[model samples]
Target: LRELKTKIACTIGPSSGDRGTISELINAGCRIFRINFSHGNLELWKEWTDNLRQVSSSLGVDCVLIADLRGRSIRFASPIDAKTYSAGQTFYIVRHDGREGEVPSVDSPEFFEAVSENDVLVSDDGRGLMRVLKRETDKIMVQALSKLTVRRGKSLVIRNKEIPIPNYLSHCVDQILDAVRLGTDYLGLSFVTSPRDILAVREFLDKNGSDIGLIAKIETISAVANVEEIAKVSDAVLVARGDLGMHFPLEEVPRLQERIVGTVTAIGKPVIVATQLLGSMISESVPSRSEIVDVMNCVVDGVDVLMLTGETAIGSYPVETVNWLRRIIETYEGDVRTRREISQDQLVDRFALGVVELAEALNAKIGIYTKRGNTARRISRFKPRTQVFAASNDPKTICRLMMLWGVEPIHVDSKEYDRGLEELEQKLKEQNLVKRGDTLILTYGLLDKPIHTIRIVQLIS
Candidate 1:
């Protein structure tokens, strides 16, 4: 099971929020746990973060928390009554109205300016689809394409339209501050369109004296159009197909994902493939064959993380979902094409490739000492055939590496090089992971520090 290179990340919500289930997820191969600030409040955030910390600590596993910030976006204000719309039905949208009937209002009055004829409008996160028929000064008329019960404050997304972002990004800024204060390992910024959006978040984090890793979610056409810039700024990229599908045709998502993943990987940044990996598992114990094929293809595409959102958050089979995901990953990971074929422009990436070749020559497990989790991620870009271990003083660093392909993260506190090695050997022995006469190719340093040499060792039992 430790040889399973691809990592699993599950969202924490109503179903998998408890310690027992969290521990089960860890055992079932979940390396990263996400807490969506969009759905829950600060109290829930505190509870979930504290619970995950407690559970991961109790289980002695390095599990990182992703505080997903819900950025400034559009949503329905509220409705007065139960309003359901079906295909071909015309509905009116007004600004600032919270009634269930009448024209449903949007949170932003700017939405009125953004709407145009023939534009696709998705309400409640794509549950309710509508096509704009006419745009009036105060109200926009849309014909529904699906049946959905509209509710108060349900998310409203205008496909491919540039929605105005609030000053300091509203709730997202507050959530970012909260996540920094809570000591989360990663911050997932929702609906990020450009490098400036990431810079804004970075400025806020800098002001607060926190250097939390930021993951830019590519879910909008603007984001996809500027993905290269976004990927350069972000610590990672999340291929958020749910909203991406809303912006573009659903059939285009797989190709878009491949292009995005390839582009990000070329720069040696992690890319996470998210949404509906095993959606059926939320209800049934088993996933469909098509879901298995999707997981297989994602692994083939060299995605750094495969995310399960509702599958673990509100699903009936949370643990099983993770287990099946891991199983599929392990099964297909070996069949993935060699990483050597991917071209590398960065010197660090070339060095990582060299490490892979050296490890293959020595028939050794690749070992690294990392801070800020960059070294492990760089090494993971090569997708080495040998198992990889990354040791870090920061539990967050260890946890963050959980999603990297072919990398096993271990938490170690020895600052000195010699002490670190002794502790590493002891951990290897205690975990029964390395045995007598096993070869290890080791490197030590932070990303800024130059590693002039790689140390090869034959463990003596």
Candidate 2:
């Protein structure tokens, strides 16, 4: 598991929110902590963060937290009442007067746009399909299909096409701010359409001096067309297939995902295939064979992380899903591919790899002392299979560092730096992670950071 060092990330929600449960996730092999901003608020996020810190402290691991937000963008049915229109059905949409079956009345008279004969209007899939045969100045005459119930302000998206984003973006600024304040490790930009939108997110993050990384979710046809630009701004990319399947031909998603992976990997950024990865297994105790292959294929295709959606959050088999995901990540990490193709440009140039290189020569595990978590991520990027020990005074660094692959975080007070090989060997043995014959390599400094040429040491147990 220490060899490949590929990472696995899972969503956190009602099913796995407690300290013991989160520890179960870590034992199951989750490296990153994902919080869905679409569901919870600042109050909820604070509690989650506090619980995560507690678990991370006891485990001495890095756990990266990402907050995903849903903007003023449209959402379909609320699951309570769902309707579907048959393919090629004609329907009518007339403004309602406080009625459930009629078209949702909009605030502006201009909301109804010019419609052509045979135009198909779908709200929440084909559940509420309305066809326009005649267009009026204020409304359109159309045929209705399947007694469809279109709710108020439900977005009427034309099937099999792309629509420009509505002008509601300005209202979503506060949601973004809320995420930044929660100390999000990564921000998931929803409904990404072009390079401009990506830049908008970056500019917002930059102004506040919060360099939280961005993970662009490509879920629309427009996003797929503008992927290169999105990849450029994103630290990572998630091919969100749920909305993507609705916008594009569902059959085309597999090939499209391949394209996304290629583009992000070409530019030296991480990418993950998300949504429905383990959907079926959510109810069953074990994952289907097809799902297993689906995960391994992503690993071989150069995905840095694999994410679980309902499978690890709301699923009946949530814990099992995490365990299953961890097993696969560990299996792949044991192979050489996890670190073999790393790009120097992807890692920080100033961070010392020389000490790590020397450790490789002597076959030693590297120990680093730090105050912040950035240095460890830079080191892990090198893909060194060395046993990593980061002794930090701060518990947050230890917890955040636990999210990194292969790097194990340990906490030692400032006074403990005086301990030489005997102390190092004793600590390693006490942790029970290393044997008496194992060799330990250590490095650190007062300040001047990641570049502080890792002083090499040989600790024999």
| Top lDDT prediction, candidate number | 1
Which residue pairs in model 1 clash with each other? 78-98, 79-99, 79-100, 80-99, 80-100, 81-100
Error of 2 at 216 (Å): 2.3
lDDT of 2 at 116: 57
Q: How accurate is candidate 2 locally (lDDT)?
A: 0.65
Candidate 2: tens digits of C-alpha lDDT, residues 1-461: 33235567778887777787889888777768888766656787778877887897789766788887774445432322444345455444444444455333433333355345666655543345566678766556666644565544344555555544454346457877887777767777777787777677778778878777777888777889999988887667888876676566568877888888777665546676777777887789887888877777776565667788777776777778877776776665545343334447644423446555677787888777766655565565555657777767765566556545556767666644435323544566787867755566666544543245355444353
Regions of model 2 farther than 4 Å from truth = 1-4, 17-27, 40-62, 77-80, 84-162, 166-171, 180-184, 205-211, 225-232, 262-268, 335-405, 409-456
lDDT of 1 by residue, 1-461 (tens): 46577778899999998889998998888878899876768888888888898998888767778998877767676674558987889978777744445557876767887788999888654567999998888888889988877766466788777776656355587788788888898999888778989998888788878888889999887899999999999888999888877777778888999999988887778889999899999899999999999999999877888999989998999999998998899888887655565555566667778888999988998778777778678778877888898887876676667767778877788865556656776787798888999998877654556653478889887
RMSD of each: 2.5, 5.8
Error of 2 at 21 (Å): 4.8
| TM agreement with the true structure for every prediction | 0.92, 0.70
Looking at model 1, which ten-residue stretch has the lowest summed lDDT? 444-453
Model 1 misplaced regions, further than 4 Å: 1-3, 79-84, 98-103, 123-127, 152-154, 166-171, 341-345, 445-449
